[model samples]
Target: MYSLKKELLKKHYKGDNKSVEYIFNRLTDYCGKPVRYNMSEEEPDYKWDFYNSLFFVITVVSTIGYGNLAPTTSFTRIFMIFYALIGIPINGIIMVTLGEYFGKSF
Candidate 1:
């Protein structure tokens, strides 16, 4: 049981880390920035600013679907479809495994 739990945690962190890296890379590639950080730059505000984009990614992987912010461009939208396809399940598994571990401990 301990070994199984350890494996689950290992897989979860690995996948989650990859997902986060992908989100950050995508945001940077798309020039997303936080709302507050926008003042420092002379560029137009994007729909998926850094903070909002991070929130968006978290909401997506966690299946929250807040519907507040979203990808505007077709490319980004398409990319998100694929991203979610892979990320959501990994995150769900992680949450469930962690919950089970804690529940068992308690």
Candidate 2:
């Protein structure tokens, strides 16, 4: 299993040193082994992180529009509009509840 994994990694990397190192580091991290490479060389990809997703959802629901990560395609834009239409009221209720709770606490 270990040799197969190593072979697959080598084939996937195809001799690109940077990609090899990146995959090696990720594998090591997943396996709880000590990482041998400095992780700062690569910029982190946050396309699906929690904060980005929450920000996107909040912007859509609040009608505040998008920032740098807005949808670029027509289909996605249409979907987002429908989603906002459905979600805005729900989000409003949530915000109002939170606001009231905080107001009472303070």
Best by TM-score: 1
lDDT of 1 by residue, 22-105 (tens): 544544555553322121334455665688778888999988898766777999899999999999999989989999999999
RMSD of each: 20.9, 11.4
Model 2 lDDT per residue over 1-106, tens place? 3564566576777767878777776777787755444434343355778988898888888888756467769999899888988899898899999999999999
Instruction: Give candidate 1's root-mean-square deviation (CA, Å).
Output: 20.9
Worst 10 residues of 1 by lDDT: 33-42
Q: Which model scores highest in lDDT?
A: 2
lDDT of each: 0.68, 0.74
TM for every model, in the order presented, reads 0.52, 0.45
